[model samples]
Target: MTHKKLILHVSLATLSGLMIFAPVATIPAQASSVKPSSAMLKKSNSYYKKHYKAIAKKYKFTYSAQTGLNKSGTIYVYEKTKSSYLKKSLSLAMNYWNSKLGRQAIKVGSKKYHTVTFSVSNAKASKSDDSDAWWIPSTKKVQIRNSLYADDLSVITNTTLYNSEKSLVKTANANLAAYKAGLSTTDPDYQSKLDTYQQQQVDYAKAAFDNQESNLKSGLAIKAREFEYANTLAHEFGHVMGLKHSPNKSDLMYWASGTNDIYNYNKVKNSSKGFSLVTSTDVARAKLAVKVHNARN
Candidate 1:
């Protein structure tokens, strides 16, 4: 299969009050037959063919020494489940990467989709972090939870909007502190000012809360099926490719959307043709990773 060069355009606002937009980069096509190590391919292909006839028939199984990641060497898609949205979501995610990289080694298998549940570690297990998907480094396998869906991402998006609104309220409260301190029982307009300020805070908080709910119901509902699901799927796969989390929020490798709230909202706003746009930083790192592997070998 032929693949076009990956190109990404990004805008950056500099400290000097100038917005700098990076030029689009066109990377040349790589050779088609960059095969993976035979030993790993033999084992992975055997596992797929023995258990998943559908997968064996559909995808080419190969390994890539350039990536130093055996997982991407062969793409194994679990059988389609009863949930059609989920099946489509997974397919879109897989296709997004494959088309961009020109890697068509995919296999559709009958193996049940994988899931990871968090069991209480001990008596003091009040806090638990459950993952929808994970990439196991040792085994080089990507495990996707059974509950993956488009609407599920609303939790994160809503939380971010909620926090941004809270930040606004906090700032308003800080501004009111001086006015509150100067108040006295003798003052005529003191009560009215206090009442107005309090009302303003209340109104601000309510507005923020309402926007959060509205965005979740409206914006996220539409985006989840289109770009968000594809973005999420690609993020998980980046981990499987041995990529560490990137500091840049726009990059697929960024793991902490909650802490960097504004970027989460911006991501939903700036999606490319039914999917999140992969940034130049992501492509550069991926190339560097492959280059590093080649240099070492």
Candidate 2:
């Protein structure tokens, strides 16, 4: 089957075939050179350090005073709250685009920052009455609800059941360690156990996906909130990149924001073999946007 059709088919199944796992990229060699601005307030700098430091190093871009939050050339990730998910999600979203669209040079900040500024609001403030997140095209700012800090996916990943799913994630690491100990010389039952663990891992992932969806729909604990928020940021960023929602529900830019498809925020996070990042269609459009943008400027 064609690649696009395959994705649609997999997405339609809900949880039958797992999406292919993309190998996580290694941190850039000189991770220390990219220092974020201390002036930008955040809940913790650790998220920037651990998740975004590498991207900053690789891209080496910052907010442009020239553009002045014009949503042209360079995009700034302003943090409205101290939510770690917000920080990580914005950084990941930017990095995802940077990979596809090519990086832009920045004129401000220390080394290069994601451009964060916390907005304190005591009153209940959200993008709209019906939405959890939205990107304001005119303001050139991405506003996320402050509640994102508390109702996040990490809550699930830190729990016992979540740890079992995590173990499935670590199974490859375990097998690698065993092979390093001496492949053929390793414990004979290890391979059998690894196989069993692998299957159990898939089962756990499927179960986790279902449970997370139910939780999302029923207003229960958010099982994959971090991943969902990251996807949300990516989706909105697609708007910022001058792209519209796709008719294909499997695409990240699907119009309904994953309400009915496998790309549903919860399902994609749980069912994607590993890191549920944006889809190929999203990347392609972003690349086109960047190309047209660069040509005009």
Candidate 3:
């Protein structure tokens, strides 16, 4: 599969001044045919096989290493219980404007779609934080064919999203932007570099988010206050789908909260802030309006 050359974190200099996270240290590039971790490839391929081909040829596909969408998308949330931490967080994820990023998801156009499914976690046999999520192979195929790869994670789910450090989110977002830029028609070899860059970026982001969260953070639970906690989930979801901050301070996707209450876990904003979890850009990239395949492999 071909893809864009968007190896993960290079230098923040490529992006304008918006980056809030520092650049990761460099690593040598790898050859093609370097398979992704089994978990990442297995899930990503399913997402690609499910959605990428459905995208119309008329629309130019946009993607990089960490994140991208066809013309539209479907974000799938997988969890096992109705009240598990993951489930509660996903509830806010699907709420849109009620969600910081989900609200923005509507704006990115017909490129994406987000779907949530519940799978109960079996305690004793499995730990509560054992679950992870992804876009499925159909989405992966789009990235692979475009030469895209994941640097941080294939998909961000309940604990993974929030448990991550704030700085790591900044890094992934930049890598994602670089990946997206590679797909620009302006790039001379968009397809040629897409796969390697994508793979490296995605792999890099996953490791960074995971390691940083463990290294930099100590302890903190998602604050209660169903509505506010939901918004937080929504905000994090925006990061998951590759959204950046909005200039509008009132916007849920803003870099800082306009209300000075981002910490209010249950705060529900029926005000303009309430909307979907995935941002418009997130949807635009997913190529969601296309058809759906059977369950994930």
Candidate 4:
């Protein structure tokens, strides 16, 4: 055999091995440095330190009708008397989780925040109406109503708001005192429990996906388009809450879903919808109805 032929054969074998076992890249070491914003940092530090003041409170993730608005927190879904679309969506999701979806994890805010979804009647059904921007204050963090909305916007780790959460949040923390007392990160039981917990989350997501078809076919698709904020909802609830869009192209939050799907926009019907959070560019052209209760004088 020629030396050149032998070299080609070796290359093919190496390529085959790589195809069989693709290597995983290490998660970036400076992952924390991907700071959302500098203003967010300064505002968050001052807000948390001042209001929470040495709060060792821990949050837990659980399936409860009490999602987002916990016993200690507040989240209200309201519709103004005038906007029909806003009324419909709020009415649609009012008690949506009384069944299976209720079994899924939900975002929970701290006790301080009076979490609310004030659906304005004159405001139309637009989720981007200027009114809703209060939920996600732009660069200005101090103006945020509570620390939960401003600082503790659920990002990386999903925590539950249960009684046993104090230790749950600290479970990931490598406390020297616990290590010195004999607790080890390598304990089989600890590893096993963590694996089961993570697997449960994946399983729950799979179940959620299974219902996606039905959800899309039903009132949700109409609501999703009429409101024109499915992307915002998915981005806010899923990504901000630590879930990524599946590799599948069908999900609305797909990284590449931006080019405007041929199916969604073509058939989306227009309704009596207004905006709660308008894009910065839109704020100049259209006047949105901000809720009377929440209006800034």
Candidate 5:
């Protein structure tokens, strides 16, 4: 008898896979001319030299002094995407950082001064699965996946639901001891009671997950998409400013697309206080990077 060959196929999907491309470029040698001097630059350099490691430890983002700024203390950004909406998004990101740093450290300019280039394309090219955008440190380029603009919101919805379920599972696991406190394995009905209790927990979790998913898919759907795009752009811009992934879930530079950040933005987008997508730590780090770059140049 001949046996047929067996085959198996597996598929995996993710919400967002924003990543920083490798091969970090070396910092060029500084010119022999007089080093630029300013009060903010001096303070930034002093603060960074003293507390960067502590800041990194606290904020969980890798530090680098790789600013794309020119000798005039401006990093020119060229928008090759040619989309007004994207331009606006880029402006928002630039303005947010400038406001935080109290300087025009970044600018929109011609290709000659364009150390940082922004573009949008539908082609996946070298991107990984579910990647929304990426930053190349070596070339200082950012490419946003155009497909995200027209996405159906299913990805964000599913990720939100999955996170909710995972949180519920964690809570259940933590309460397992309490769940078995009054039950004895020697009793004939113990297994049934335990199973019923577990099932009730599962049912409650399911209901909560369903409610969150529904809310995300309905009233918050559009805002969710908008937040994702804006956050992704800002996150890539963070990379441009020499910041790596942040471990804090609420930060825009968080490793993935930051569903928590997205949720927070949606909640406070219309608030009087407004939402700060970039955390204080992010601002501090970027300011240090700019100061270092300027000092060196």
Candidate 6:
């Protein structure tokens, strides 16, 4: 998810110059791995509070550290959409963060911590053309374009294709077995027939493997797009939790949307290998944000 800088010539003061906050410093990999001392954590919290408050004051926006999380440290989100599809996507996004952090960092509903609201609509022409979702800090709203919804048709198609492939594999194996069992070793051409059948089977097996591999890759791609949508929602939620864009493009907090990082499961950089939705740096920053908020209140 990327924030679109919108300039409005309206009388509504709060929405006049709506923009996202500036990028924060990227956490080093080693720093994220080592637990910080209380002194260091306090220093970091002071810096974050000063930085965020400065930005909000300069921009005439409200900055409330007391809003997004409860004292129990869970972020409760509410979705304001009637569509079950969008609701499920938000649920998946929240689950992604909670799993990565290994705790109940985000819950689906509770007005006590409803500092974040998720909603969906068609892409507005006023917003940037490339953005799939945007988050407004002052309003505590995350808006996702309806186009980002997963394709139900693709899922059905993949399932049908899988069943067809399974049936074909079973039939092929049975036919090959039947052909081999019916062969008569007493015939003069028995050896030639056996050799030919063996060769045909080898060829068929290789062809089938290749086809299945191709189909598997295609199916994985569809799944990846679905994951990307959920990842985008999670990315927006990251903003609500006080995370800024990362300099590392592989990170979930990166500024751009639709980089297709989920497709590369191998976690290789500069390749088709997939990476995790949230890096350790993102988790560390989110946890730190929670601590800062808790300390502030």
Against the true structure, candidate 2 reaches a TM-score of 0.43
lDDT of 2 by residue, 67-153 (tens): 223334455555655555456555655555566545642222222454323232233532323244555443445555555334333
Candidate 1: worst-modelled 10 consecutive residues by lDDT? 1-10
Candidate 6 lDDT over residue span 117-224, tens digit each: 777767643432535576766566688656534333243234334444565567667877788789887889987987788677667856865664465456544444
- Quick one: ranking by lDDT, best first? 5, 6, 1, 2, 3, 4
In Å, residue 214's CA in model 1 sits off its true spot by: 3.8
| lDDT (0 to 1) per candidate | 0.44, 0.43, 0.34, 0.27, 0.58, 0.56
- Whose TM-score is higher: candidate 3's or candidate 5's? 5
RMSD of each: 15.1, 16.4, 22.2, 23.4, 11.4, 12.0
List, residue by residue over 1-297, the lDDT tens digit for candidate 4: 000000012212231111111012111122121212333223443353453312211111111112223232223333223545434533332322212123322332233443433322222213222221122212111111122212211210111112113333344333433443464677768766566665655565456444543444554444443343323332223222222222333332232222122123223323334123312211111111011111211
Backbone clash total for model 2 is 1
| Candidate ordering by TM-score (highest first) | 5, 6, 2, 1, 3, 4
Assess candidate 1 and give its TM-score to the true structure: 0.41
Give the higher-TM-score candidate: 1 or 3.
Answer: 1
Give the Cα error of residue 243 in candidate 5, in Å: 1.6
Model 6: residue 234 alpha-carbon error in angstroms: 1.3
TM-score of each: 0.41, 0.43, 0.28, 0.24, 0.54, 0.53
- So what's the TM-score on candidate 6? 0.53
> For candidate 1, lDDT tens digit of each residue in 1-297?
001111111122211121111112221222232222433233443354454323212222111312314333444555334655545556666676666655653344445532211111122211132334444444434444444333245544544465556666787788678669878867898889899987887787788667756775675545544454455556555544434545555556554321132224545556444554455555544443333333333
Displacement of residue 85 (Cα, Å) in model 3 is: 5.2
lDDT of 1 at 195: 92
Off by over 4 Å in 5: 1-67, 111-113, 125-130, 152-224, 257-274
Q: How many backbone clashes does candidate 5 have?
A: 0
